[model samples]
Target: MLHLRAVCPPEQTDQAIELLRAHAGTAHLIVHRGAAVAPEGDLIEVDLAREAADEVVDSLCALRLDRTGGITLEALDTALSDAADAAEEAAPGEGADAVVWQELLGRTGEESRWNATFQAFLVIACLLAAVGVITDSPVTVVGAMVVGPEFGPLAALAVGAVLRRWDLLRQAAAALAVGFPVAMVFTGAIVLLGDAVGVFDTAAIVGNHEVDFVYQVGEASFVVALLAGAAGMLAMTSAKSAALVGVFISVTTVPAAGYAMVAAVAGSWDRAGYSILQLFVNLVGIVLAAAIVLILRRRKQRSGDLLRPLSRG
Candidate 1:
């Protein structure tokens, strides 16, 4: 459900209220009038049904309340007395399935900006991967995976493609274009330093069959990427974020990128190529899968019939 707050000028208040009241779903409405507020008009609070949230939000967007005055919308989770019975009756068919594309797209827009925190995370992730390669510690490798913030941009890319948001697409592509090369270069520098200190040798880095195998592309890599993409989308859209840990582990972005840096430092072009290939495969799979998921989810919502109001007993 959503709780919407709209504060507008005195003249426009009635129009806005009417538009909100006429929204597609059942809504409990409250109105407050105040003069001190800059808007100096009306403040409305609406508790709307969950099933009709998307349509309600769409309608609100159409009203362009922000341009008219000051409008803020917040989703409320508190159960209203009047809504409890209706919720109980509707619970059975309220499957976990919900189209979250719009929400996901909205969130991506909110978080896609390049900031200091993003830069710090990227640097730290690369450094961790470099250390892991030098030490050959799988634990450090996992740490790098957890620390890597590349997923945000990757997710933004998929969301942008699905929504056809050019701004998001540009931002996401820029992040990737700038981030990966920088990380790889930093990792390469660390490898060079480690070699100088006798902490790592070219032969030790390349001879590790396990690391080599990670770089080799196969059908299973595609499957893992696809599954990880779907899981990632679900994690981002749903309230459950713990599921993202599993998705992160399944994707080879950090591992492959780490391996590539190690191979480059060791002057092993074949391994570097393989690692790059793996990275490419995983990226392609995730984007394609996310796009498909969004399309299908939207289709389901469009096809489902809306629930009717219950009669009083």
Candidate 2:
């Protein structure tokens, strides 16, 4: 279930009421006329089922309330009322399968931005992976994998492609285009400095096989990347955050970047090239898999799954 809070202009109050009053999934409705001080309108609230949210929100958007006033939505972890149960039962589809496009676009827009905090986390992850690869530590590589924030933009890219949003596509592209190279340059500089001081060498990279998988790109690497991408997208759309950690650990994006920079510092261009290829493979796999899932989800949501109750019947 979801709680929808909408501020309606005085002129549109009756229309908004007329809309929600007729929806079967509206378990509860409250109207406070002239209560919106800032917006100078009425405050309308509705407890609606998750499956019916997209339909209702679209209707609300059609009224231009999103521009004139505002609408906010929040998911209810638990609803004990019989009215709520009836609303859920009355809705067309399962709550778990609902794909609220507005919510997704909002979330991915934020995630796709290149910010200081995101940069810090990526650089930190790269540094960690650099150390891990040099020491042949799989544990440290996994730690790096968990810390990387690369998936945010990748998922955003997938969303943009499916939704045909050019702005989102550009935002995600700029983030990845600038962010990875910056991090790699920083990592590479650090590695070269460490080598000059006799703190690092090519011997470690050439002989290290324990964490060699970070650089070796093959069929298995692409398959793992695809699986992780699909899982990550499903988790995002369904609001299942716990599954995201597994996605992070399953893909080798961060580790590949680390290996690429570290190998370049050791003057192993061949290995560095391969490491970059590994990174590309993971990224392409994730985007491709996620885009396919989003297409299928949008189709399902737009098909015969939606049901509308007769107005005021």
Candidate 3:
């Protein structure tokens, strides 16, 4: 279930009430006229079925309430009321499968940005992977993979493609374009300095066959990329934070990028090429997989899955 808090202008209060009352999925509607001081409007609150959220939100948007007032939605982790249950039962789809566009857009919007913290995390994660590659340590590589924040933009890019949002797509592109290269350059410089001090060398980077999978581009790379991509998208859309961690370590994006830098600095052109290819494969595979999932989800939502209640298992 979803809880909605909408502030409606006086002129639109009747329309809002009419719309909510007409919807079978809406329940526990409470109206406080002239209660919203900041927006100077009536405060309307209701509990809605997850499946019905998109339609209701769209209606509100169409009414221009989004511009004139405000609407905020929150997921109900547990709703014990029979009224809530009836509302859910009256709705069209399962809560778990509902595609709450507003929530998704808000989530991806924040994540897709190349903020200072995101950049710092990326650099730090890549540097850790660089160390892992040089030391031939699987643990350090996994640590770097978990720390990398590249998935945010990648997920955003997938969402943008599915929704046809050019702004989001461009922002995601710029983030990856700028963030990765910058991290790689910094990692490469670190490698160069380490090389100058005799602490890093080409042999250590190229001879680690145990972790060669990080740089080796082959059939398995594509498979892992596809799986990771799908899992990543599911995590983002479903609010599965724990599953997200698995997606992080399951793919080679960060490690490959770090390896590319390390190999380039060591003058191992072939190794660098392999690492770069691995990175590209992972990126393409993930985006493609994620885009497919998002499109399918959108389709399902349109098919009234978003309006139907979940069947008790």
Candidate 4:
């Protein structure tokens, strides 16, 4: 369920109230006239199911409430009232599977930005991957994957493709276009510094078959990437963020990039080519899987049969 808070002008208040009343999914509607000081309008609050949230928000936006007033929707984590139950029952689909397109747009838009913290995590993760490749340590590789923040932009890119949002596509593209090269260059420089300090040597980087998995491209890598991509889409669309960690570890994106950087630094064009190919395969698989999921989900939502309530089970 979702908790919606709205501020509406005096003239629009009645129409807004009527809209809520007409929808069986809304409950416990409350109104306070002339209560808002900033926009100076009536304050209205209601609880509605996730399945109905998109339509309601769109209808409200049609009134230009988002421009003149405000409309906010938040998850109703623990709705103790029976009215909440009735609201969910009245809605078309289950909360978990509902798309809530507006929320998704807002989330992806914010996450796709190429901000300072994003670059820091990207660089640090790549550096860690470089260390893992040089030391032949799978633990360090996993740690790098966990620390990498690359998934956000990837997911945003998929979301953008689904929604046809050019801004989101542009932001996600820029993040990847700039982020990976920068991380690789920085990791290469770090490798040089480590070699100077006797921390990394050519032999340590060469004979490590254990870490060689990062560069090897084959059917298994593609399969794993596809599964991880689907799981990642689920994590982003639903409230199951715990699965995101699994998505991070399952895909070899960061590790591959790191290994490619190390291979390039050592002037091993063959190994570098393999690593780059692996990275490319994983990236294409993930993006394709995510885009497919989003497209199917959007279709299901449109058909009004996407999410089934727990009670229906």
Model 1's alpha-carbon lDDT is 0.70
* Residue pairs with backbone atoms closer than 3 Å in model 1 (clashes): none
- Order of candidates by TM-score, top first? 2, 4, 3, 1
Candidate 2 on 46-130: residue-level lDDT in tens? 9988878888899999999999999999989888999899888888777777877888888899999998988889999998999
Candidate number with greatest TM-score: 2
Cα lDDT of model 4 by residue, 189-233, tens digit: 888887778878744667646888999899999999999999998
**For model 1, how does the per-residue alpha-carbon lDDT over 57-150 read when each residue is reduced to its tens digit?**
5655667655665545455657657554454344323424544445677777666666777767877877776667656777777788788877
The prediction achieving the highest lDDT against the true structure is 2
User: What is candidate 3's lDDT per residue for 1-313, written digit by digit as tens?
Assistant: 8899999999999999888888878889999999999889999999998877888898888989898999999888888899888888877657666778888888888898998898999999999999999888899999999999999899999989889989999999999999999999999998899888998774677565677888889998999899999988887776465788899998999999999988888789898999999999999999999998898888876766443433322
Local distance difference test, candidate 4: 0.87
Between candidates 1 and 2, the one scoring higher on lDDT is: 2
- The lDDT for every candidate, in the order shown, is 0.70, 0.89, 0.87, 0.87
Candidate 3 to native Cα RMSD, angstroms: 2.9
lDDT at position 117, candidate 1: 77
- Which runs of model 2 end up more than 4 angstroms from their true locations? 305-313
